[model samples]
Target: MIQGAGTVILWSATIERQADRPLAEVWDNLDAVWRRFNDHEWLSGKAHGHAHRVDGYARHTALTVNEQGWHPHFHTLLVVSRNMPREQAVRLAADIAARWVDAAEHVGVVASTEGQRIGLPAVALPTDSPHQARRQAHREAVARVQYASHQAWGHPGSIAGTPEGVFRAAAAGDADALDLWHEIEEATHSHRLRSVGGIFRTPAAPRR
Candidate 1:
C-alpha cells in the first residue's frame, strides 16, 4: 500500500545576461544547482530514505527553458513525500531557494508552489470507483516497474521513467513509441509533473 501522496515544490530563478547557449547547457547548469541543494545536510534530513540520511537525498529535477525571453530561468520541481506538513515542506523548499539564490548573483529565486497546476490536463477518477481498488492496482504496477528498473539500472526508477530516457530507449525500433514518449515529455516539460496520491497516476498527474 502507498504510505503517502507526493508534493512537488516548484521553483525558478532568472539570469541577467542571455547567453546564446544550447538548451542542454542550461539544463546541465540547473541540474547541478539543484544537486547542490539536495546535498545539503539540513535539507537532507527531511528526505524519505536512508540514502538521504546524510547530505544526499533522492529527488528529481526538471529543467525548462523559456525561449520567450522570460529571463532565461529554470523551473524546478522537488518531490516530497505527502506525509510532510505544508509549513515544513514550504520551509525546506525556502532553504533550497535561498542557497541557490546566494550561489549565483544573476540567479534570483522565483515563486514556489505546492504542485504543478497549469497546462497539463486533469485526470478524472471514475465516479463509481471502488475503494482501494483503483489505487491498489496502480500501486502494484508502480512497485513492479520501480523495482525492475532500479535493478536494471543503478538508479532508483521514477514512477514513470524519465521522458528523455524513455524516448531514447524506444527510438530505435518503435517510431510510435518515440512519438508518444515525445508528446508526454513535451507536456511534462511545459506544465511540470504533478503528483496524485498513488504511485501510478497518469503522466498528467505524476507523483511529483
Candidate 2:
C-alpha cells in the first residue's frame, strides 16, 4: 500500500464456460475485452458522471482449460485514493463490474457481472490510525487474491477437480485434456500474466 491508499478490492471477470468457440478465438476475445477495460478512459480516474475512486492497481491473469473450453480471467487489487465505508466500496465494485461487462459485450465476449466480486478493507481498531487501517486493508486484499488464484484450480487434495484436473488428466493421457493443453500453450505463449497501471506505473509506487 502507498501513502493515502485505501479501500482495497478484488475484481474478477471470465467468459462463458460453455461457449462452443475454439480455444484460440475465445482467448483472443477475452484478451481484447481485458485490454478494452483497462484502457477505458472512464476507469482512468474521475469520470463525467461518477467518481472512479481508484488511483492505482495491480493485476494477475490466469488461463485454464477444461471440458468447458477456455477459462481466462484476471484478479485485480485496486487501491482507492481514500478510505471509504463498506457500502460505498460495494457500490464502487458494482460500477466497475458493469463497465467490465460492457467491455466484454463490446468485444463479443459473453461474461457475467456476477463474477465481478469485491473485498473491502479490514475493520480498523479504535486506536488505529488511517495509515494503519489502509495497511490492514492491503494485507486483506493480497490474501484474497492469493486465495482466489488457488481456488480457481479447485480445493486441495482433489486431483479430479479442475482447472487443475485438466492438467492431471492430460498427464494421464486423457485425450480431451491433452488437446486442451495444446491449445492453452498456443494461446498463452508470449502473453503477459501480470500488469500494473495508473499511479502504480510511477517509480514511487509501493510493491508488496
Candidate 3:
C-alpha cells in the first residue's frame, strides 16, 4: 500500500478487448480501466521527473488492432511514483486486469468473461538515478508507444524519430515537436499519447 520515496516502478501492460468492438468504444473501455487504477493506487508521495502527486502516476499508451479486426488493444507504459515490491506490483496488476473486464462491462462495452486483458510486468527505478538508467526506462516506454501507434497506423517518420526520441520530445518545448505529436494523435484520433497525473508528467517542455 505504501513504499519508499525516491523510487518509482514502471509497468508495461496491454489492455485488450476480447471481441472486435468499435474504435471509439475501445478507447472508452481502456479509459475506464485507467480511471479505476488511478482511483485505487496506494498513495506514495514520490516525485516523478517533476514534482507530482504524492501517489502520482504517468503512462504512455498507443492503440492497435488486435490480431483480428474485431477490436483494438493498448500497449501501455504505466509509471508509479513509488517503490513497490515486485510481488505487490504483480498482485495489483492482476487485480487491475479483472477490474478492466468489469469496468468495460459497466460502461456497456465488451464485458465478456474474456472481454479485457491487461498483462502487467514491472521494474523499478530510483527517481534520482543516472541519465542512462532513466533513458533505459524511457526506452521501454518508447517501445510500447511506437508498437501501438505504428502497428495500428504506420508513421512515415518514426513517431519518436529514434528509439529514445519520444523521451527527448517529452521535454522539448518546440512547437514543431508538439505539432508532430498532434499529427500522431490525429493519425489515431486519440486524445492523448502520454498521460500524466499530479505534478508528474512524461517530460517537461524544453525551455523556450
Tens digits of per-residue lDDT, candidate 3, 95-143, equal: 5466565665565555433433333332333455665565455455545
Q: Residue 119, candidate 1: how far off, in angstroms?
A: 15
Model 1 regions more than 4 Å off: 1-17, 40-43, 46-77, 105-208
List ranges where model 2 is wrong by over 4 Å: 1-5, 46-50, 121-163, 202-208
Winning model by lDDT:
2
Model 2 per-residue lDDT tens digits across residues 4-93:
335566666676764576667876777788878766455555555456557667787766555566667776777665666667778878
lDDT score, candidate 3, position 184: 43
- Candidate 3 regions exceeding 4 Å error are 1-22, 36-54, 80-82, 111-124, 127-190, 202-208
Model 3, C-alpha of 65: deviation from truth (Å)? 2.8
Count of backbone clashes for each model? Answer: 0, 0, 8
Clashing pairs in 1: none
Instruction: State residue 10's C-alpha deviation in candidate 2, in Å.
Output: 0.8
Cα TM-score of candidate 2: 0.71
lDDT of 2 at 21: 65
Query: Largest TM-score belongs to which candidate?
Result: 2
Cα lDDT listed for each candidate: 0.40, 0.65, 0.47
The whole-model C-alpha lDDT of candidate 2 against the native structure comes to: 0.65
